[model samples]
Target: MKEVKVEKLLINYKTLEEFKRFKEYGHQELSMLEDLQSNIVENDSESPFYGVYYGGSLIARMSLYKVDKKYDQYFEPQHDYLELWKLEVLPHYRGKGYGKSLVDYAKGYNLPIKTNPRVNSHGFWERMKFQKATYEMERDFGQNPLIWLPEGISERNTQ
Candidate 1:
């Protein structure tokens, strides 16, 4: 496998088409298409979505959204953190480290990161050193959240 490069994606027809192949395709893709066509977002605007292409085809992808410090619920001192989502590697590309590479790119930011991973991905997140936050009935309702904190930061008080 060749080294993969993670790029911030643009909302274009091609990108939209490749997105259809992923199981997570739904509101997010629709929203981007609407935003792009209405000029609410420029065609090549910087998006939180990132992906790796194999031979001119996008095969794996993820999205990372930075949360404002004021709204942060999972880190001490209320610093900005990344919320990672929609991490998927095509079936044919599984086990080749594409998913791991996308995750590693998110880690490169060196910020506290959180993800409500797809149910089947627990082992992958564990291997990536992510740990489940201490359960909070109110805050974590209906979701199992996993998080990674860079050295200087800390997990928030879930109470």
Candidate 2:
């Protein structure tokens, strides 16, 4: 596989159109368009989303948002971490390591990472060394949380 260049997608017709390929395209996507047009965002704004393109086509992508330390409830040292979501690889590109590459890109931060494994994707998350956060009735209600910790950081286990 050729090198996949990961870039912060800009809000524009091309990008919007590219997103339509995603099943989860919805309000959040529209909001980005709206924000861009309304000048709420810079023309070339740096979005939290990062994606890898294969010769002008977006084959894999993921979003990693930084959560403030004040809201840090998952890690032991109580530091800021990334909330990873919307990690999707184009159906045609499945099994090509693109998804894992996107994940590996996120891990480049070496920060505590949290993600909700899509149904049946538990094995992938596990293979990536992400663990289910010990059930927290209040914090993790209705969600299966998977987390990856860098060295020197630990999960705040629930008793």
Candidate 3:
């Protein structure tokens, strides 16, 4: 498999246009566009989005946000963690490891990661060594979160 370079996408019209090709485009992206149009943010501002381009076209992407420890209820020791969302690969890019590569890049941070995966993606997350976090009504209402913990870390039981 060819190595795909994951890059931190900047907030720009061109980058927003490329995002339209992704299926997960929604409010977060719209908010960015609004910020750009209103000049509230400068072009090329750093965004939380990271992606892999194929032949210069973005073929896969994900949004990773860091949640401070004070807001963490998913792990033991109450440490900061990554909240990964909107991970999507173009239909043609499936099975080529583009998604996995992006995930691996996230794991390189060495912080515990959390993601509420889309329906039917359980197998992929499982294959990535993530396990379903025990659900808590107040903390996890309407979300089924999966988590990946680095060595010497474990989930806090919410049951």
Candidate 4:
């Protein structure tokens, strides 16, 4: 299997246009567009998005944000970690390992990662070795989060 290069995406008109092809396009993307249009952020400003491009087209993408340890409520150590979101591969590009490649790229950071799986994506997250976090009413209200921990890290005792 050939490796797919996951590059950090920049916030630009071209990049935003490419994002329209993704199924997860929503308010976050629209907010970026608004920021660009208003010049509140520069055209090529760095974004939290990472993606795989094939033949010059974005085929897979995800957003990763680092959360400070102080705000951490998911992992045992209470250290800084990554919160991954918006992982998607274009419909035509599914099952080609593009999604896995994007996920592997995030795992390369070696930080514990958390993501709220979309409905029906449980199998994928399980395949990725993520476990459903024990739900806490106040902390996880309206969300079901799955988490991946690097060696020696474990989920905090949510019981």
Candidate 5:
């Protein structure tokens, strides 16, 4: 298997245009476009989006956000954690390890990770050793969250 490099996507027209190939393009992307149009965001600025490119085209992508411990509700130690979202590999790229590469990149931070996996993706998260987080009606609302714990960390017992 080839090594995949997950790169921080730049906030620019080219990156945004590349994003249109992704299935999850929606409000978040549109907001970025709006920001660009209004000069609210500078070209080549840092973005939360990261992705793997194959032959110079984005084939997989995910967004990772670091949540402050003050708002953390998923870890036993109440420490800062990464909230991962929109992990998607293009249909042609599925089963090729690009998705795993992105997840592994996030895990490299060694911080606990929380993600609301898309429907039917539970198996993939499970394979990555993430476990279902105890659901809190008030904290979780309608989303089912899964979490990955690094060494010396554990999921908060919401029970």
Candidate 6:
């Protein structure tokens, strides 16, 4: 397989149109569109959405958000971390390493990462070396979170 390039998606109608092809397209994207129409966010401004394109069409995407230390509950030493969500590769693009490419891109940050894997995707996250976060009723709130820790970082002990 050729190298996959994960890119930061620009917030624009074209990008939005491309996103509709994704199954995960819903509130997150609709809100972005509304924000664009209302001038809440500029068309080409930086966005949390990132994607992989194939033949000039978006084939995979994920959103990465930096959560402040004060809100960090998954990593030891309480530092800033990335919250990864909405990772999806179009049906035809699955198994081509596009999903792994997007994940590998997130790991490039070298920060502890957290994500709630979609049902049946636990195996994939496990393959990426992410471990299940210890459940804490208040923090977890029924979401089964998986986490990846970078060098020198450890999972926070929740008790």
Candidate 4 lDDT over 1-159, as tens digits, reads 687899988777777778666635443532333433443255567678788999999878787899998988878878788989878877788889898998899999999999987778889889999988884437677788888999988888867
Residue lDDT tens for model 1, 77-135 = 88898989778777788899998899899999898888887767899999999999873
Candidate 4 weakest ten by summed lDDT:
27-36
Question: How does each model score on TM-score?
Answer: 0.84, 0.84, 0.86, 0.86, 0.87, 0.87
**TM-score result, candidate 4:** 0.86
The regions of model 1 sitting more than 4 angstroms off are 24-41, 135-139
Candidate 2 displacement at residue 29 in angstroms: 12
lDDT of candidate 3 over 1-159, digit per residue (tens) = 977799988777787778766635443532333433443265566578888999999888888899999988878888899988878887788989999999999999999999988878899999999998884437666778889999988898766
Candidate 4 achieves a global lDDT of 0.79
Candidate 6 C-alpha error for residue 100, in Å: 0.6
lDDT of 5 by residue, 1-159 (tens): 878899987777777777766635443522333433343276666678888999999888887889999988777878999999888887878998988999999999999999888878999999999988884538676778888999998877767
Q: Rate the local accuracy (lDDT) of all candidates.
A: 0.78, 0.75, 0.80, 0.79, 0.80, 0.80
**74-98 in candidate 2: lDDT tens per residue?**
8888988898887878777888888
State how far residue 6 of model 5 sits from its true place (Å).
0.7
Ranking by lDDT: 3, 5, 6, 4, 1, 2
How many residue pairs clash in all the candidates, one count each? 0, 0, 0, 0, 0, 0
Error of 2 at 140 (Å): 2.5
Off by over 4 Å in 6: 24-40, 135-139
Poorest lDDT segment (10 consecutive residues) of candidate 6:
29-38
For candidate 4, the clash count comes to 0
Model 2 global lDDT (CA atoms, 0 to 1) = 0.75
Error of 5 at 42 (Å): 2.0
Error of 4 at 14 (Å): 0.5
